[model samples]
Target: MASHSSSKIAIYGAIGANVAIAISKFVAAFFTGSSAMLSEGIHSLVDSGNGLLILFGVHQAEKPADARYPFGRSKELYFWSLIVAILVFSVGGGMSFYEGVEHLKHPAPITDPTWNYVVLGLSLVFEGISFFLAFREFNKSRGDAGFWATLGRSKDPSVFAILMEDLAALLGLVIALGGVYFGHMLDNPYFDGGASICIGLLLVSVAIFLIYKTKGLLVGQGVEEETLDALEALARQQRGVEQVRRPLTMYLGPQDVVLALDVEFHDHLSAIEVEKTVDELQDTIRANHPEFKRIFIEAKGLSGKQRNPLAPDPTSPQI
Candidate 1:
């Protein structure tokens, strides 16, 4: 819960920064007639909107489970994150690419670049602050894995979406700076358009990556290896349990997981004993993994037909 709260903090910070930067970039772009500058403005504006959507999603995700939705609205976060990816592609990437093509066809000289430089510099600073905040929040839960691995494993989409948007913004600013400088240096306006195209491509790539990542979380994904292991070990500790099958786990949200286990209790155990053992096992599991909102344990033989998530080896890492 604390980590989720931190993600909201990071998101709120990014929203403020992007809104300020977008307004400045639009003013400068209007004055300078720089294609790259316009693209940057659009990028910031899209990011600002995305931040709002994420906040809304986060709120909706927290809605308590009701008759209509038994598992609650936790997946709403994933749905909104997917929309963020779509927005980046359609608004940021599409607009920039279209502007780039138009500018390349009939390039126009940029007016006084002084304002452009000033705005770009300020944007870089704002984006840097936002990026740092996101990275700090993300780094808190990243463990020892590399950044890319952490991104892939992260269940929270709000933090990562902001991180990627800020990352793209920073890189886009650098490209915009180069384009503006060189367009004036060589008396060629097409360089500005080329930079816009590059920024568009960058946004496209970031959007695609976000889509891929969010899809897994939205559809449902397995719990981490350590978490599954702990649950499995807890089940085995129960008396009269001869064997435990691979536990099936699904993430309903970052903090909510549904777990199911197929266990074969010893044939010698009485019905009352089996019931007693089951209750103890559940208590132990809930104590160890508070994330398990629902746990279903069935008494069934391991016929080798039902695949075990922990199969192949008892100690191997889960996917």
Candidate 2:
């Protein structure tokens, strides 16, 4: 709950910063007729939209588990973040590329200089502030992990998504300012067009990367290797469990996992004792791995055969 609240606040800050940057870029584009500035404006607009989507996702993901959805609504975070990435690629990158191509075909002269640079400078400052907040939150969650590791392993997708977007925004701002500055230096509108194309390409690349990671989560990817190892170790240490036959674990959402384990237990335990041991093992495993919200355990003897007389066939051939 606290994490979700903090993410909402961070996203709100990002939205405010992007709004200011969008306005500044729009004004600069109008004053100088710079394609790069215009492209950046569109990028900021997309970022603002994505921030709102993330905020909504944060709210929805906090809902408690219900009958129809017993796993709660955490996966909504990934679903919404994926949509944001697709929008950035389509609306932000695609439009920027189209505008750049148009400018290349029909170049326009940029008249003003001072106001354009002023707006670009202000945009950099605003985006920098937003990036700082996102970085602070991400670092708090990351602890000793490197930045790339945090990006890959963080349970809160919103913070990581915001971090990537903010980084891309900062780079886009630099590219836009450079395009204008260099275009003026060389007296060539082509420089502005080229810079716009580069910015679009960068945004597209980032969006694609985000989509790839989010898609994996949405498709029920397995838990991290470290998490799986932890679960395995806990299972092996439990009494009456001789060995772990197979352990299957998958992430239902951020910080949530569903685990299925096949274990070999001592053959001497009676039915009631076996049930009690299994229950105790479940409690122990859950206490050890808090991330596993759903657990299924199958217990068998050392020979890989069930000890209970009424146990289902282990290898029943289907017709």
Candidate 3:
């Protein structure tokens, strides 16, 4: 719950900054006729819309389970994150690239770059603030983990998505400043168009990276291998258990996981003893890892035999 609140904070900050930046950029682009400034305006507008979409996804994902969806709607966030990536690639990157090509074909000089400079400088400060907030929240979640490693392992997309967008925005601002300065100094409009093209490429690369990260979550990625190994060891330690197969686990949300385990008990254990052992194991697991929202335990006799005739086939894969 705390993490969710923090993520929302970062997202809200980014949305506010982007909205302000977009308006100013559009105004400056209108007056100066700078291709790079126009592209940056579109980028900011798209980013604002993406932030709202992420917030909607987070709200929907928090819905309680219903008969139609027993597992809840936690995966909705992943779906929306995928949509955000597609929007960045198509609306943001595609438009910027197209705009740059058009500008190059019929180049026009900027008579006054004063408005462009003012808007770009203000945008830099706003985007910097947003980036700092996102970085702080993400850093809190990561603890001592390295930045790239934490990003790869993170399940929450709102914070990381904002972080990535702000990074790209900052870089694009720098590129736009250079384009304006150099085009004015050299009396050449090609430099401005080239900067827009470079910003388009940067946005495309960021979108691709976001798509790759969100894909795994949507496809039911499992817990870390070390986590699985620890769970298996814990199951094996329980008395009356002869062997324990590796457990199957999948994250339903950032803090929700579903776990399944197959345990082979001694043939001599009575029905009551087996029941007690299963109950104890479940309690132990819940105490150690509360993130597991659902747990299914399958008990089997030694030598691949079912303890009860009604039990599932022992030869079939349980995990």
Q: Return the candidate ranking by lDDT, descending.
A: 3, 1, 2
| Maximum-TM-score candidate | 3
Per-candidate Cα lDDT values, in order, are 0.86, 0.82, 0.88
lDDT of 3 by residue, 67-139 (tens): 7878888899889999999999999999998988999999999888999999999999999999999999889
Worst 10 residues of 3 by lDDT: 308-317
Q: What number of clashing residue pairs does each candidate have, in the order they appear?
A: 0, 0, 0
Model 2, span 4-102: residue lDDT tens: 677777798899999988988898788879999999999999999999998888878777787777667888988999999899899988999888899
Indicate the worst ten consecutive residues by lDDT in candidate 1: 308-317
Any residue pairs clashing in model 2, and if so which? none
RMSD of 3: 4.2
Ranked by lDDT, the better of candidates 2 and 3 is: 3
Better of 1 and 2 by lDDT: 1
Q: After superposition, how far is residue 264 of candidate 3 from its true place, in Å?
A: 1.5
